[model samples]
Target: MKGKEKIKVGITIGDLNGIGGEIILKTFEDNRMLDFCTPVIFASVKTISYLKKHFKFNLNFNGINTIDKIVHGKINVFNAWNEKYNIEFGKENLKSGELSIKSLKEAVKYLKSGDIDALVTAPINKHNIQSEEFKFPGHTDYLAQELEGNSLMFMVTDTLKVGLLTDHVPVNDVTKHISEKLIKNKLDIINLSLKQDFKVRKPKIAVLGINPHTGDNGVIGKEDDEILRPALSKIREKGMLVFGPYAADSFFGSNNYKNFDAIIASYHDQGLIPFKTLSFGNGVNFTAGLSKVRTSPDHGTAYEIAGKGEADENSFKQAVFTAIKIFKNRKEYKNLTKNPLKPKQKKI
Candidate 1:
């Protein structure tokens, strides 16, 4: 679908010791998936071999010395690391963290170089992946810095789409990040992403309230009524179809989310909790407003079931499909906008 060629998706094996390898291998176990897109997993060949043996999986991957050697219809492993390291399943270690960052850096290099059409990242343990080299709270922040673009944590599924106004901040600190200007900027990012990435011509966005009961006209908290309402008004005045400071409690419960193209929540849990609850096994985490396309499984490293062969591959597979869908959508959007046609007028 990508210019008459299968899209090459570059994947980063999250924490080597986590369920990243298991999920990645399981996703590509069926050879038929290669027909949709070429997968290039950025991990050590030895790591994958070890996981295969440990899990008794029959997945096959083609190891390449360089990205140029990638086979057209094979699972390619771009061995980012060659050294022998201990991979303790279900345990967080410094070595696993280091390798995770190394794999991500390699994938990012190819992504920026246009070597891959999109990137699908495996889950990483945030605490273990922290190091002097990788010092962001999570993938969203790291990618924002590396790509030099503003990023929004947008969750996607066929049924619903959710974007967080404030991501990865503590509950106590979420309010500090909420401002009129910040809300408007985030809304603009979501709007642009809907049109450019998802191909929504005129996106209708729903903004959630921060306080309980939407601050009850300033009786509970002034931020929702004062900050969110004014911010949304300006965003709408700028010609974006945006609505709400709607109460978070009833928004999703009443199924009001189905009415809009995308929903914007004030904080992380306000949006993610509902989204994950509704679409945990099928949701895809899409990093919107990035120069390059990136998506990841909605769930994180399930270390408890890392080697048990119980981790679900549905989300990972959906991430791959979502990335491909978005990539194609963006391409078509570009083609449509490159030389837009004029509207016909009626005789006066």
Candidate 2:
């Protein structure tokens, strides 16, 4: 429950064997979660029941069998399916993976139908969840394909935001994917998302080059001068506040990352390695360029600490809060565009 007037968010529980169920229980510990948005979760009643027994979370909840009858208490659950099975905590199994992915797909239906404002996904392990029923590398790619958005994978924390140009690719193949067009497309997604989705007035983006020492001006590699720098010029011409081809190794030192609103990296590790180092436990992964808002925790399913009541729920909490906040901002942004908002300050 998010709105005093109506529901605001639809949450999906990820793999049950992982800490998804535990975090969902812990993250919604605040009574204020109900006030921010109506949360319709796509999960199983059986899984929910199991967690309540182990965790002993005392909240008024409704296990809804169908979407039409969902009502809020402390939590509202819409069962994606009605199957019940015993699951071992801190362990990976194929059935739990299938259940998690099904829940995600079912949640997307509500998103597409406008039944929910935004979605906050709990952690799911990609390796375990890659069976025939669930073939996605992760939620970001799955949501991109489903929503048909030209999207970039953005890992956001309180202080830093990193957008990947080529995600889930090997280091050897990273340079091959770094091109003028690819960088522009990723930047376009990041820039537009900053405006319409996040309400950033003018976003300054930093682009990292593709090699160590930023290619050392062709001493190490020419990809920096030959490729990335040219892309920066084109992005600037479009009236965006973007810079860099910043050095790959030194960019994260001494608060240098705070200089820009967002950093667009040449590849996956180029961006994530540093970001995880800084905000590993607190980061949130936001999928940019989708029509609907979607965010997930930055870290994956921590199987080691899944069931001991030891998994920190901060990132999960952040993911949920980020979705709810962005939902309101996007609404305001849409309202501004629809009514063509008057300028707040007059020209001097």
Candidate 3:
């Protein structure tokens, strides 16, 4: 596809009981969004109609049963399922989980087949979404299994970017999960992502330590000294601009993160807490290093303000914009690297 063409963006309606509907409706309500890319929402027209009525949204959409029927410059609602969903605001419903998974699976199918250029998923209830078919922790794990390439949960904004070394792992198992291979692989992914996805020619990355004060040189813990430092040393030898087992406590507070292009956290909360604290309502959860582009709002199902129309759509809007930007960046990167120029040969 050419760089100027509008890409197809597949969207999943997350938990019906949460703020997914509200945010989606509020975002597309402005017609200007359709000018960038065509949005294909993986939900029934009936479902969206219900949401529109509840929120009194004045948006117009095209309903279709097949992918070929999508209309450009309009919101397309593809009916993934025919059954009517019972949306009880601010409540957990197993049926809502089933529907959310259904929407995700269908959207992923189109995403894999290249019918869609990128994907922007809504939030789902982690606990309720668990079932026989979908046993993974969240979108990152599920997409990692379905799509090619290693996956990294990258939380991003215009200025700040953070990737997770270990995501969805328990606090006790975080130390056990850290290894040299994992660190190098994640660094490679982030470095590549920065160049191709974010247009960074030379990316600088910072790695946060597992323990406080980076194990204080083994006084606090041995993992930082034994595992993290050695891995970083080997990585640096390979000519990648990677640095630090910096103390997680002081990394953000000291504003040291601003010096680097991206930061890698040892675990989930250590990265997310600081990320959301800094960029909440504007940050996007991007699944980096995958063959296909996928992004989501940084926040999850906000059940408390589900149907009150109080949910913020900034993160969701940013997710869409980020997905479209990455899609274009990848295309440009591929075109630039498809055929390399040869160096001048020395006189024979």
Report the number of clashing residue pairs per model.
Answer: 0, 9, 0
Give me the displacement of residue 93 in model 1, in angstroms.
Answer: 0.9
lDDT per residue as tens, model 2, 1-348: 243455457787888888888888887766777776667778877778888788888766778877767664447888798878687888888888888888899899888888777888988878778976667788888898887798789998767889999999888888888778888888999998888766788998888878888888799988888888888888799798998778878889867788888898888888898998999688989998888899988877788888889888889888888887778888889888899957699779
- Please say which candidate is ahead in lDDT: 2 or 3: 3
Candidate 3 structure quality by residue, lDDT tens digits, 24-91: 88999988888888999998888999999999999999999999988888899999999987689999
Candidate order, TM-score descending: 3, 1, 2
How displaced is residue 169 in candidate 1, in Å?
Answer: 0.4
TM-score (all chains, Cα) for each model: 0.96, 0.94, 0.96
Question: How does candidate 3 fare on TM-score?
Answer: 0.96
Tens-digit lDDT track for model 1 on 248-312?
99999999999999999999999999999999699999999888899999988888988889989
- How does model 1 score by TM-score? 0.96
Task: Put the candidates in lDDT order, highest first.
Answer: 3, 1, 2
lDDT measured at residue 149 in model 2 versus the true structure, 0 to 100: 91
Residue 185, model 3, lDDT: 94
lDDT (Cα atoms) of all candidates against the true structure: 0.90, 0.83, 0.94
**Candidate 3 Cα RMSD after full superposition onto the native fold (Å):** 2.3
* Model 1: residue 84 alpha-carbon error in angstroms: 1.4
What shift in Å separates residue 213 of candidate 2 from its native position after superposition? 1.2
